[model samples]
Target chain A: MNAQFKKGVLDLCVLAQLAKGDKYGYELTETISQEMTVATGTLYLLLRRLNEEGYFETYLVETPGGPARKYYRLTPKGLAYTQSLKDEWITFIDQVNRLIR
Target chain B: MNAQFKKGVLDLCVLAQLAKGDKYGYELTETISQEMTVATGTLYLLLRRLNEEGYFETYLVETPGGPARKYYRLTPKGLAYTQSLKDEWITFIDQVNRLIR
Candidate 1:
């Protein structure tokens, strides 16, 4: 896996994970990392950036005998953006598939 | 399309194009731009970078009543690399499709 390729789609992966439901940082990281080669640092930075950009909102929930866990919920804008990215990615890959195969 | 996404796959696209036959910079750029949002500047920069990285070799071809056009041909390394990228892309997209849909 290329480093740039991982960086390119990491945001989309995070958004797609949240699209399923609100998830805390560790859950999101573990889910995506399981499927791809993503660094914890890169995932956290993307989360912070998207958070600052208003694509996601965070809420803290208390856990038993543990610190509060902050979960990320996708905003309306995030949902729309994810849809667009998904559409583009599908189209792009389809075109490449035709060309390469 | 996201700019970073474009940046990430541009190399694969160019190498795939050259895998078919040799092409000058403008021809490659036009072909890819028809399907996606890629700037001329970015395409040229990518070409230069790949050339410097030894994935591509360039040669000048004379055009009748015009200046010579520099065409790009894929190196053995480029072919192998393109194959790897293609494999990774297919696998990654398949995983994402399963998760998202």
Candidate 2:
């Protein structure tokens, strides 16, 4: 897949995944990477930016064998942003499909 | 639609448009912008880049009362690039749809 195209939708993927359930940094990166070839480094940077933007809030959860895990949860703003982007995504793909087909 | 998402597909959009038929700069922008909100200025810049990258070839078509219009047609490279990107587009969107849905 095109790198730029993947970058465009990366935020949505992260947001939607969190909407399903909260996941820690490594866990979130793993889930997204399973679906696409995104670099964990890139995902970390994006996660920081999204958290700073108030779209996501992070909390620390203690693990039995390791240090606390930093998990991300969607804020209200994030949910609203995801919904709007999801709607736009449908329309955008439909328009491109029309022209390409 | 997200501007970044639009930017990611803009190259494919232009290439796909040329694959349909030859079009001058203004005419191509007009056609694409009708389906989606793209700035003509941005389209012109992309046309120049694609032409420079050898994906597009240009010709001059003289009009009766107006200046000769510079037209763009998909080159062999452009066609191949479009096909590859189109294939990638299908898979990419499918992956994203799976995650979001």
Candidate 3:
């Protein structure tokens, strides 16, 4: 796969996943990596970018079974952004589908 | 749409379009902008980035009816990169589709 293209959408996918609930970096990375092969380093870099962009806010939260994890949660802006991305992706894919067909 | 997300995919889309044939910056921007709203500045920046990355090479081509235009053509590396992107996108979308369904 094109690592760069995968890397490009990684941020949006991470934001979309966090829209459901707060998740720590490792958990998020694991979840996405399960669906698509992604390196921990790439995921971490994207998480940092999202945090820096103010799309996500992070805090240390203790888990019952383990040490405190840095949980990432989406802000209102992030949710809105995700919705827009979904819409655009649908439209873009629809067009591409027609062209290919 | 999420401007940043749109911005992220714009580069790939531009490269894909150029895979069909060589096109000048304005023509490429116009072609993509027909399907997706993109600013001229943004398209130029992407073109410049692709050129800098050596994925594309540009040269001036004269048309019978108009002034010479700068045409952008993809290198072999660019085609291979585009193929990789397409494969990754297919896999990623398939996963997302299954999840949504």
Candidate 4:
């Protein structure tokens, strides 16, 4: 994968994952790394940026099995943003599919 | 479309377009804007970044039909980079497709 491409999509991918449920930084990094490669530092940086952008809000939450985790959840703005991304992706892929065929 | 998604995809999209042939800044912006919205200033900034990264090399070429234009084409590194991006995109979309179904 292109590092630049990965850099670009990491934020949105993180958002998509968080939209399903609140997740702590490490857990989010672990999940995304399973599907695509990303560094822990990079993930943290992106998370901070998204939080700063108001796409997400985070707070400390205690887990039954472990230490308190900094859980992250999407803001209303994030959900709306994800929907728009989904639409654009569908359109872009449709065009690419045609070209490939 | 998601501005963030657009931000992510724009570089790949621009590279893909240039892979077809060399083009100037304005033409690339106009072409992409037909399918996706992007500001001219953003396009130039991205172009500078890509050029700085050595993904592309640019030179001014005089056109018989008009003024000299700054044409951009992929370097060998850029082509390799684009190939990597394509592979990642395919894998990512395949997963997304399965989830959609």
Candidate 5:
């Protein structure tokens, strides 16, 4: 995948994943990495950035006999942002597919 | 559409268009603008950046009784880059569709 191209949509992908439910850094990375190549370091940075931007809020959850994990959840702002990105992506692919096909 | 998402894919879109043949700035913008929102200024900047990156080369075409139009064509490097981007896009979309749907 083009690095530049991935840079464009990675945020939306991560946000969409979080919108489904809270996820730890590793879980989020694993889910998206299943669909595409993504660096765990890069994802962590994005999570931090989104948190600072108020799109996500993180909380630590304790698990029995395991370390507490920081899970990410979308804020109202994050949900709204994700919805807009999804709309844009759908419209974009629709147009591109029409043209290319 | 999400500006960032568009930013990721617009270069690939433009490169794909050029790989088909040469195109003027207006023509390129008009072709892509049909499918997505892009600022003329932004496209121009992208053109310049791609050119500098050796992904595109420009030439002036003399049109009868009109100003010379600047047309863009893909260099060998540009062609290779476009092919790679196309492959990545196809895979990315395929994965994303599966995940999102």
Candidate 6:
């Protein structure tokens, strides 16, 4: 798969995963990486950006013998953003499908 | 639409447009822009890059009373590139759809 293309949809994938349920940074990485190629560096950067943008809120959960895990939960705004990105994906793909066909 | 996202697919879109037939630079841009947002600057740059990568060939077609228009036609390589991009698009979208669903 094209890396740029994959990067383009990573945001959507991350948001969608969070939509399923909140997950810690590594957990989110694990879920998305399972489906496709994810540059962990890019994923973490995206997570921070999304959280900064108010699309997500993060909470730290501490483990007994380890550092706290930062979990991401989609805020209402993030849900709305995800829907918008999904809609754009649909419309964009539809046009490409028609052209390629 | 996210500019980066749209950009990621623009190479595919441009090649798909030429797959039908040849087109001049502005002509190709117009055809794609009609359906979705296309940054002309980006499209031209993509055109040049794809051509350099051997995905397209260009020729000048003189007009009756205007400057010659450079047209783009798909080469064998361009056709193959288009197919690969189409395949990538399909696979990428499938993953995204499944995730977002």
Q: Candidate 4 on A1-101: residue-level lDDT in tens?
A: 22233235555577778778888999987887666556799888888988898998889988899788898989999989876666655676765543322
Each model's TM-score, in the order given? Answer: 0.85, 0.88, 0.61, 0.61, 0.76, 0.89
Return the interface RMSD of the candidates, in order shown, one decimal each: 6.0, 5.7, 7.3, 7.3, 6.0, 5.8
Per-residue lDDT of model 3, residues B24-63, tens digit only: 9989877776665667998888889878988998899888
Error of 4 at A78 (Å): 5.1
State which candidate has the highest TM-score. Answer: 6
Tens digits of lDDT, candidate 1, B1-101: 22233246667788888999999998987888666666789889999988998989899999998789999999999889888877766676766676566
Listed for each candidate, the true contacts retained, as a fraction, are: 0.19, 0.43, 0.04, 0.04, 0.24, 0.41
For A1-101, candidate 1 gives per-residue lDDT tens digits of: 22233245667778888899999998887887666656688778889999999999999999998799999999999999888877766776766666566
Candidate 3, position B76, lDDT: 97
Docking class of 2: acceptable
In what order do the candidates fall by TM-score, top score first?
Answer: 6, 2, 1, 5, 4, 3
Share of native interface contacts present in candidate 1: 0.19
TM-score of chain B of each: 0.87, 0.88, 0.81, 0.82, 0.85, 0.88
Each model's DockQ score = 0.25, 0.34, 0.11, 0.12, 0.24, 0.34
| Cα distance off (Å), candidate 1, residue A85 | 2.4
lDDT per residue, candidate 2, B1-101, as tens digits? 22233246877788888888998999878877767877778888989988899998889999999899999988898999888878777877877887888
Clashing pairs in 3: none
Best by lDDT: 2
Candidate 4: pairs in clash: none
Error of 6 at B7 (Å): 4.6
* CA shift of B100, model 4, Å: 9.1
Residue A62 displacement (Å), model 5: 2.6
The TM-score of candidate 2's chain A against the true chain A comes to 0.87
Clashes in candidate 2: how many?
Answer: 0
As for lDDT, the candidate ahead, 3 or 5, is 5
Structural similarity of chain A in candidate 6, as TM-score: 0.86
Tens digit per residue, CA lDDT, model 4, B32-76: 776655679988999999999999989998889978889998999
Error of 1 at B47 (Å): 1.5
- lDDT for B6 in candidate 2 is 24
